[model samples]
Target: MNGNTERQFATNVYYDRTFDCDAAKILPGEFYYTGQDMLIVTVLGSCVAACIRDRVTGLGGMNHFMLPDGGDPASPVSASMRYGTFAMEVLINELLKAGARRENLEAKVFGGGAVLRGFTAMNVGERNAAFVMNYLKTEQIRVVAEDLNDIYPRKVYFFPRTGKVLVKKLMQTQNDTVAKRELDYASRLKVEPVAGEIDLF
Candidate 1:
Protein backbone atom coordinates (compact mmCIF):
# COMPACT_ATOMS: atom_id res chain seq x y z
CA MET A 1 0.00 0.00 0.00
CA ASN A 2 1.07 3.59 -0.66
CA GLY A 3 1.98 5.99 2.13
CA ASN A 4 -1.26 7.93 2.14
CA THR A 5 -3.50 4.91 2.02
CA GLU A 6 -1.57 3.20 4.79
CA ARG A 7 -1.83 6.25 7.00
CA GLN A 8 -5.55 6.55 6.35
CA PHE A 9 -6.14 2.92 7.25
CA ALA A 10 -4.15 3.22 10.43
CA THR A 11 -6.04 6.34 11.44
CA ASN A 12 -9.41 4.77 10.84
CA VAL A 13 -8.53 1.68 12.82
CA TYR A 14 -7.03 3.68 15.71
CA TYR A 15 -9.74 6.32 15.87
CA ASP A 16 -12.46 3.89 16.83
CA ARG A 17 -10.32 2.23 19.47
CA THR A 18 -8.61 5.28 21.00
CA PHE A 19 -9.86 8.69 20.09
CA ASP A 20 -7.81 11.72 21.16
CA CYS A 21 -4.89 9.82 22.58
CA ASP A 22 -2.42 11.52 24.89
CA ALA A 23 0.93 12.70 23.60
CA ALA A 24 4.10 10.66 24.02
CA LYS A 25 6.75 12.69 25.81
CA ILE A 26 10.28 12.57 24.40
CA LEU A 27 13.22 13.36 26.63
CA PRO A 28 16.72 14.53 25.72
CA GLY A 29 18.74 12.21 23.43
CA GLU A 30 15.57 10.51 22.31
CA PHE A 31 13.08 10.54 19.41
CA TYR A 32 9.57 9.28 18.56
CA TYR A 33 8.03 8.55 15.14
CA THR A 34 4.57 7.51 14.05
CA GLY A 35 1.77 8.01 11.54
CA GLN A 36 -0.98 8.04 14.14
CA ASP A 37 -2.91 11.07 15.42
CA MET A 38 -1.19 11.31 18.80
CA LEU A 39 1.11 14.24 19.55
CA ILE A 40 4.85 14.16 20.22
CA VAL A 41 5.89 16.46 23.06
CA THR A 42 9.14 17.76 24.56
CA VAL A 43 10.46 20.61 26.68
CA LEU A 44 13.76 22.21 25.76
CA GLY A 45 16.32 24.76 26.79
CA SER A 46 19.74 24.66 25.04
CA CYS A 47 18.80 21.31 23.51
CA VAL A 48 17.21 21.34 20.04
CA ALA A 49 14.20 19.33 18.90
CA ALA A 50 13.57 18.74 15.22
CA CYS A 51 9.98 17.89 14.30
CA ILE A 52 10.15 16.48 10.79
CA ARG A 53 7.32 15.12 8.64
CA ASP A 54 6.75 14.02 5.09
CA ARG A 55 4.07 16.06 3.37
CA VAL A 56 3.06 13.15 1.18
CA THR A 57 2.99 10.20 3.58
CA GLY A 58 2.00 11.85 6.89
CA LEU A 59 4.88 10.00 8.54
CA GLY A 60 6.97 12.00 11.00
CA GLY A 61 9.09 12.09 14.13
CA MET A 62 10.80 14.40 16.65
CA ASN A 63 14.30 14.25 18.16
CA HIS A 64 15.93 16.13 21.03
CA PHE A 65 19.72 16.54 20.91
CA MET A 66 22.59 18.48 22.44
CA LEU A 67 25.63 18.87 20.18
CA PRO A 68 28.56 17.73 22.25
CA ASP A 69 31.44 20.15 21.87
CA GLY A 70 35.24 19.49 21.84
CA GLY A 71 35.11 16.83 19.13
CA ASP A 72 37.45 16.84 16.15
CA PRO A 73 35.68 18.89 13.50
CA ALA A 74 37.36 16.91 10.74
CA SER A 75 36.06 13.56 12.00
CA PRO A 76 33.42 11.49 10.25
CA VAL A 77 29.78 12.54 10.10
CA SER A 78 28.86 10.30 13.05
CA ALA A 79 31.70 11.57 15.22
CA SER A 80 31.80 15.30 14.60
CA MET A 81 28.19 15.90 15.54
CA ARG A 82 28.17 13.34 18.36
CA TYR A 83 24.66 12.55 19.58
CA GLY A 84 23.27 15.30 17.37
CA THR A 85 23.97 13.36 14.18
CA PHE A 86 22.64 10.13 15.61
CA ALA A 87 19.45 11.79 16.74
CA MET A 88 18.80 13.39 13.36
CA GLU A 89 19.59 10.25 11.38
CA VAL A 90 17.44 7.98 13.51
CA LEU A 91 14.39 10.25 13.17
CA ILE A 92 14.77 10.67 9.43
CA ASN A 93 15.49 7.01 8.74
CA GLU A 94 12.49 5.87 10.76
CA LEU A 95 10.27 8.27 8.88
CA LEU A 96 11.55 6.91 5.57
CA LYS A 97 11.05 3.31 6.64
CA ALA A 98 7.49 4.23 7.53
CA GLY A 99 7.00 5.53 3.95
CA ALA A 100 8.14 9.16 4.14
CA ARG A 101 9.66 10.59 0.99
CA ARG A 102 12.93 12.43 1.17
CA GLU A 103 12.01 15.22 -1.23
CA ASN A 104 8.70 15.83 0.48
CA LEU A 105 10.11 16.09 4.00
CA GLU A 106 9.49 19.27 5.99
CA ALA A 107 10.86 20.29 9.38
CA LYS A 108 9.78 22.37 12.36
CA VAL A 109 12.61 23.01 14.82
CA PHE A 110 12.40 24.45 18.33
CA GLY A 111 14.34 25.14 21.53
CA GLY A 112 18.04 26.12 21.67
CA GLY A 113 17.51 28.77 24.31
CA ALA A 114 20.41 30.38 26.10
CA VAL A 115 18.63 29.73 29.35
CA LEU A 116 21.77 28.54 31.07
CA ARG A 117 24.19 31.37 31.96
CA GLY A 118 27.42 29.50 32.61
CA PHE A 119 27.60 28.10 29.06
CA THR A 120 27.66 31.60 27.57
CA ALA A 121 31.23 31.20 26.39
CA MET A 122 30.40 27.88 24.73
CA ASN A 123 27.24 29.37 23.23
CA VAL A 124 25.63 25.92 23.31
CA GLY A 125 22.20 27.03 22.19
CA GLU A 126 23.45 29.05 19.25
CA ARG A 127 25.72 26.27 18.09
CA ASN A 128 22.93 23.67 18.28
CA ALA A 129 20.55 25.84 16.28
CA ALA A 130 23.17 26.47 13.63
CA PHE A 131 24.06 22.79 13.41
CA VAL A 132 20.46 21.64 12.98
CA MET A 133 19.69 24.33 10.36
CA ASN A 134 22.80 23.44 8.40
CA TYR A 135 22.22 19.73 8.71
CA LEU A 136 18.68 19.97 7.34
CA LYS A 137 19.89 22.17 4.53
CA THR A 138 22.61 19.71 3.59
CA GLU A 139 20.07 16.88 3.60
CA GLN A 140 17.82 18.98 1.32
CA ILE A 141 14.96 19.06 3.83
CA ARG A 142 12.96 22.30 3.94
CA VAL A 143 12.44 23.76 7.40
CA VAL A 144 8.83 24.94 7.27
CA ALA A 145 8.89 26.57 10.75
CA GLU A 146 11.22 27.29 13.65
CA ASP A 147 11.43 29.16 16.99
CA LEU A 148 14.98 29.16 18.21
CA ASN A 149 17.85 30.92 20.01
CA ASP A 150 16.04 32.86 22.69
CA ILE A 151 16.65 33.17 26.45
CA TYR A 152 13.71 31.10 27.70
CA PRO A 153 12.71 27.44 27.64
CA ARG A 154 9.92 26.22 25.36
CA LYS A 155 7.35 23.44 25.40
CA VAL A 156 6.70 22.00 21.92
CA TYR A 157 3.78 19.89 20.84
CA PHE A 158 3.95 18.36 17.36
CA PHE A 159 1.21 16.54 15.50
CA PRO A 160 2.88 14.27 12.96
CA ARG A 161 -0.04 13.52 10.70
CA THR A 162 -0.93 17.15 9.99
CA GLY A 163 2.56 18.61 10.23
CA LYS A 164 1.31 21.08 12.83
CA VAL A 165 3.39 22.39 15.73
CA LEU A 166 2.48 24.35 18.83
CA VAL A 167 5.17 26.10 20.89
CA LYS A 168 4.89 27.75 24.29
CA LYS A 169 7.70 29.92 25.62
CA LEU A 170 7.97 29.16 29.31
CA MET A 171 8.18 31.73 32.07
CA GLN A 172 11.54 32.38 33.69
CA THR A 173 11.18 30.99 37.17
CA GLN A 174 13.87 30.73 39.87
CA ASN A 175 13.76 26.95 39.67
CA ASP A 176 13.85 26.44 35.90
CA THR A 177 13.94 22.65 35.81
CA VAL A 178 14.09 22.30 32.03
CA ALA A 179 17.17 24.48 31.73
CA LYS A 180 18.80 22.68 34.62
CA ARG A 181 18.24 19.27 33.02
CA GLU A 182 19.71 20.33 29.70
CA LEU A 183 22.68 21.90 31.47
CA ASP A 184 23.29 18.67 33.32
CA TYR A 185 23.12 16.63 30.11
CA ALA A 186 25.59 18.96 28.37
CA SER A 187 28.00 18.68 31.29
CA ARG A 188 27.89 14.88 31.14
CA LEU A 189 28.68 14.90 27.42
CA LYS A 190 31.95 16.73 28.09
CA VAL A 191 33.39 13.80 30.04
CA GLU A 192 31.97 10.81 28.15
CA PRO A 193 34.08 9.15 25.46
CA VAL A 194 32.94 9.41 21.88
CA ALA A 195 30.74 6.42 21.07
CA GLY A 196 31.81 3.84 18.42
CA GLU A 197 35.34 5.19 18.17
CA ILE A 198 38.65 3.43 18.77
CA ASP A 199 42.33 4.41 18.43
CA LEU A 200 43.71 1.23 16.86
CA PHE A 201 42.98 1.02 13.16
Candidate 2:
Protein backbone atom coordinates (compact mmCIF):
# COMPACT_ATOMS: atom_id res chain seq x y z
CA MET A 1 0.00 0.00 0.00
CA ASN A 2 1.17 3.48 -0.73
CA GLY A 3 1.91 5.87 2.14
CA ASN A 4 -0.73 8.29 0.84
CA THR A 5 -3.38 5.60 0.76
CA GLU A 6 -2.65 4.61 4.34
CA ARG A 7 -2.49 8.19 5.57
CA GLN A 8 -5.61 9.43 3.81
CA PHE A 9 -8.10 6.99 5.30
CA ALA A 10 -9.94 8.60 8.15
CA THR A 11 -9.13 6.85 11.43
CA ASN A 12 -11.35 8.77 13.86
CA VAL A 13 -14.09 6.22 14.24
CA TYR A 14 -16.72 6.58 16.92
CA TYR A 15 -20.39 6.17 17.69
CA ASP A 16 -22.79 8.99 17.04
CA ARG A 17 -25.52 9.31 19.64
CA THR A 18 -27.65 11.59 17.50
CA PHE A 19 -27.81 9.12 14.66
CA ASP A 20 -27.25 6.09 16.85
CA CYS A 21 -24.74 4.54 14.43
CA ASP A 22 -21.04 4.15 13.89
CA ALA A 23 -19.32 7.14 12.31
CA ALA A 24 -16.02 8.27 10.84
CA LYS A 25 -14.97 11.89 10.77
CA ILE A 26 -12.74 12.90 7.87
CA LEU A 27 -10.74 16.07 7.81
CA PRO A 28 -9.08 17.88 4.92
CA GLY A 29 -7.04 15.59 2.65
CA GLU A 30 -8.80 12.55 4.06
CA PHE A 31 -11.43 10.06 2.99
CA TYR A 32 -13.51 7.14 4.29
CA TYR A 33 -15.43 4.26 2.78
CA THR A 34 -17.36 1.30 4.10
CA GLY A 35 -19.49 -1.62 3.07
CA GLN A 36 -21.20 -1.52 6.46
CA ASP A 37 -23.90 0.90 7.49
CA MET A 38 -22.17 3.96 8.90
CA LEU A 39 -21.81 7.71 8.57
CA ILE A 40 -18.86 9.64 7.16
CA VAL A 41 -18.77 13.30 8.15
CA THR A 42 -16.74 16.46 7.59
CA VAL A 43 -16.80 20.23 7.90
CA LEU A 44 -15.83 22.33 4.91
CA GLY A 45 -14.68 25.86 4.22
CA SER A 46 -13.10 26.63 0.87
CA CYS A 47 -12.93 22.88 0.33
CA VAL A 48 -15.09 20.24 -1.29
CA ALA A 49 -16.29 16.70 -0.54
CA ALA A 50 -17.54 14.10 -2.94
CA CYS A 51 -19.90 11.34 -1.81
CA ILE A 52 -19.90 8.46 -4.23
CA ARG A 53 -21.77 5.18 -4.02
CA ASP A 54 -22.80 2.12 -5.89
CA ARG A 55 -26.57 2.38 -6.06
CA VAL A 56 -27.04 -1.33 -6.59
CA THR A 57 -24.70 -2.64 -3.92
CA GLY A 58 -24.75 0.25 -1.47
CA LEU A 59 -20.96 0.34 -1.20
CA GLY A 60 -19.71 3.87 -0.99
CA GLY A 61 -17.34 6.48 0.45
CA MET A 62 -16.62 10.18 0.83
CA ASN A 63 -13.52 12.29 0.20
CA HIS A 64 -12.65 15.77 1.47
CA PHE A 65 -10.00 17.81 -0.36
CA MET A 66 -8.85 21.11 -1.79
CA LEU A 67 -6.59 21.85 -4.72
CA PRO A 68 -3.72 23.99 -3.66
CA ASP A 69 -3.30 27.29 -5.47
CA GLY A 70 -0.39 28.26 -7.78
CA GLY A 71 -0.23 25.37 -10.21
CA ASP A 72 -0.08 26.11 -13.92
CA PRO A 73 -3.71 26.35 -14.86
CA ALA A 74 -3.10 25.64 -18.54
CA SER A 75 -1.58 22.25 -17.86
CA PRO A 76 -3.94 19.40 -17.16
CA VAL A 77 -1.20 17.53 -15.32
CA SER A 78 -0.24 20.28 -12.93
CA ALA A 79 0.59 19.60 -9.30
CA SER A 80 -2.74 20.92 -8.02
CA MET A 81 -4.66 18.82 -10.49
CA ARG A 82 -2.63 15.75 -9.57
CA TYR A 83 -3.49 16.22 -5.89
CA GLY A 84 -7.17 16.53 -6.63
CA THR A 85 -7.07 13.50 -8.88
CA PHE A 86 -5.41 11.42 -6.19
CA ALA A 87 -8.04 12.44 -3.67
CA MET A 88 -10.91 11.30 -5.88
CA GLU A 89 -9.14 8.19 -7.16
CA VAL A 90 -8.33 6.88 -3.70
CA LEU A 91 -11.99 6.79 -2.69
CA ILE A 92 -13.25 5.38 -5.97
CA ASN A 93 -10.55 2.71 -6.11
CA GLU A 94 -11.42 1.59 -2.61
CA LEU A 95 -15.05 1.24 -3.54
CA LEU A 96 -14.20 -0.76 -6.63
CA LYS A 97 -11.86 -2.95 -4.59
CA ALA A 98 -14.77 -3.70 -2.24
CA GLY A 99 -16.95 -4.84 -5.14
CA ALA A 100 -18.56 -1.67 -6.46
CA ARG A 101 -19.06 -1.88 -10.18
CA ARG A 102 -17.88 1.08 -12.22
CA GLU A 103 -21.22 1.38 -14.02
CA ASN A 104 -23.10 1.56 -10.72
CA LEU A 105 -21.29 4.60 -9.35
CA GLU A 106 -23.14 7.87 -8.68
CA ALA A 107 -22.15 11.01 -6.85
CA LYS A 108 -23.41 13.81 -4.63
CA VAL A 109 -21.10 16.74 -3.94
CA PHE A 110 -21.04 19.45 -1.30
CA GLY A 111 -19.06 22.33 0.21
CA GLY A 112 -16.84 24.96 -1.53
CA GLY A 113 -17.69 27.80 0.78
CA ALA A 114 -16.01 31.18 0.78
CA VAL A 115 -15.48 31.24 4.51
CA LEU A 116 -11.76 31.86 4.50
CA ARG A 117 -10.39 35.39 4.51
CA GLY A 118 -8.00 36.41 1.70
CA PHE A 119 -9.10 33.42 -0.35
CA THR A 120 -12.11 35.14 -1.83
CA ALA A 121 -10.01 37.22 -4.20
CA MET A 122 -8.84 34.11 -6.00
CA ASN A 123 -12.18 32.36 -5.52
CA VAL A 124 -10.59 29.26 -4.05
CA GLY A 125 -13.97 27.86 -3.19
CA GLU A 126 -15.22 28.30 -6.73
CA ARG A 127 -12.08 26.71 -8.11
CA ASN A 128 -12.56 23.66 -5.89
CA ALA A 129 -16.22 23.41 -6.82
CA ALA A 130 -15.40 23.49 -10.51
CA PHE A 131 -12.57 20.98 -10.23
CA VAL A 132 -14.67 18.32 -8.53
CA MET A 133 -17.55 18.56 -10.99
CA ASN A 134 -15.21 18.46 -13.95
CA TYR A 135 -13.29 15.52 -12.56
CA LEU A 136 -16.44 13.45 -12.06
CA LYS A 137 -17.66 14.28 -15.51
CA THR A 138 -14.36 13.28 -17.11
CA GLU A 139 -14.45 9.99 -15.22
CA GLN A 140 -18.04 9.46 -16.41
CA ILE A 141 -19.53 9.39 -12.92
CA ARG A 142 -23.01 10.84 -12.90
CA VAL A 143 -23.59 13.50 -10.29
CA VAL A 144 -27.09 13.27 -8.92
CA ALA A 145 -26.89 16.16 -6.46
CA GLU A 146 -24.73 19.09 -5.48
CA ASP A 147 -24.59 22.28 -3.40
CA LEU A 148 -21.64 24.49 -4.03
CA ASN A 149 -20.10 28.01 -4.20
CA ASP A 150 -21.89 29.58 -1.27
CA ILE A 151 -20.44 32.03 1.24
CA TYR A 152 -21.11 29.92 4.31
CA PRO A 153 -19.22 26.93 5.59
CA ARG A 154 -21.03 23.60 5.64
CA LYS A 155 -21.14 20.48 7.74
CA VAL A 156 -21.76 17.37 5.64
CA TYR A 157 -23.05 14.04 6.90
CA PHE A 158 -22.84 11.17 4.48
CA PHE A 159 -24.41 7.74 4.87
CA PRO A 160 -22.61 5.86 2.14
CA ARG A 161 -24.59 2.67 2.40
CA THR A 162 -27.86 4.47 1.74
CA GLY A 163 -26.40 7.12 -0.58
CA LYS A 164 -28.00 9.73 1.65
CA VAL A 165 -26.34 13.03 2.44
CA LEU A 166 -27.34 15.81 4.82
CA VAL A 167 -25.74 19.22 4.57
CA LYS A 168 -26.03 22.02 7.11
CA LYS A 169 -24.80 25.41 6.03
CA LEU A 170 -23.20 27.23 8.91
CA MET A 171 -23.68 30.91 9.51
CA GLN A 172 -20.58 33.00 9.05
CA THR A 173 -20.48 33.51 12.80
CA GLN A 174 -20.24 29.76 13.27
CA ASN A 175 -17.33 29.27 10.87
CA ASP A 176 -14.27 30.13 12.95
CA THR A 177 -13.13 26.57 13.40
CA VAL A 178 -13.90 25.60 9.84
CA ALA A 179 -11.92 28.51 8.52
CA LYS A 180 -8.95 27.81 10.77
CA ARG A 181 -8.88 24.15 9.84
CA GLU A 182 -8.96 24.81 6.11
CA LEU A 183 -6.36 27.56 6.34
CA ASP A 184 -4.02 25.21 8.15
CA TYR A 185 -4.72 22.53 5.60
CA ALA A 186 -4.00 24.86 2.72
CA SER A 187 -0.74 25.86 4.36
CA ARG A 188 0.30 22.25 4.64
CA LEU A 189 -0.49 21.62 0.99
CA LYS A 190 1.86 24.40 -0.05
CA VAL A 191 4.87 22.92 1.73
CA GLU A 192 4.08 19.21 1.62
CA PRO A 193 4.55 17.17 -1.52
CA VAL A 194 1.38 15.97 -3.17
CA ALA A 195 0.46 12.35 -2.66
CA GLY A 196 1.71 9.78 -5.18
CA GLU A 197 -0.40 8.84 -8.16
CA ILE A 198 -3.45 6.57 -7.82
CA ASP A 199 -4.76 4.86 -10.90
CA LEU A 200 -8.47 4.18 -11.30
CA PHE A 201 -9.26 0.54 -11.85
**lDDT tens per residue, model 1, 73-174:** 345464437566656776787778778888899999998888877765667788789889988997889999999998888989888888888898888893
Clashing pairs in 2: none
Q: Estimate each model's TM-score.
A: 0.81, 0.94
lDDT of 1 at 86: 59
lDDT, residue 45, model 1: 89
The count of residue-pair clashes in candidate 2 stands at 0
lDDT against the true structure, each candidate: 0.74, 0.87
User: Tens digit of lDDT per residue, candidate 2, span 1-201?
Assistant: 333632388999999999999999999988999989999999988899999999998999999998888877447898877777888888899899999999999999998887776764577888889899999999999999999988999999999888889999889998888988888888778777766667788
Worst 10 residues of 2 by lDDT: 1-10
What candidate 1 gets wrong by more than 4 Å, as runs, is 1-19, 72-80, 193-201
User: Which stretches in model 2 have alpha-carbon errors above 4 Å?
Assistant: 1-7
TM-score of 2: 0.94
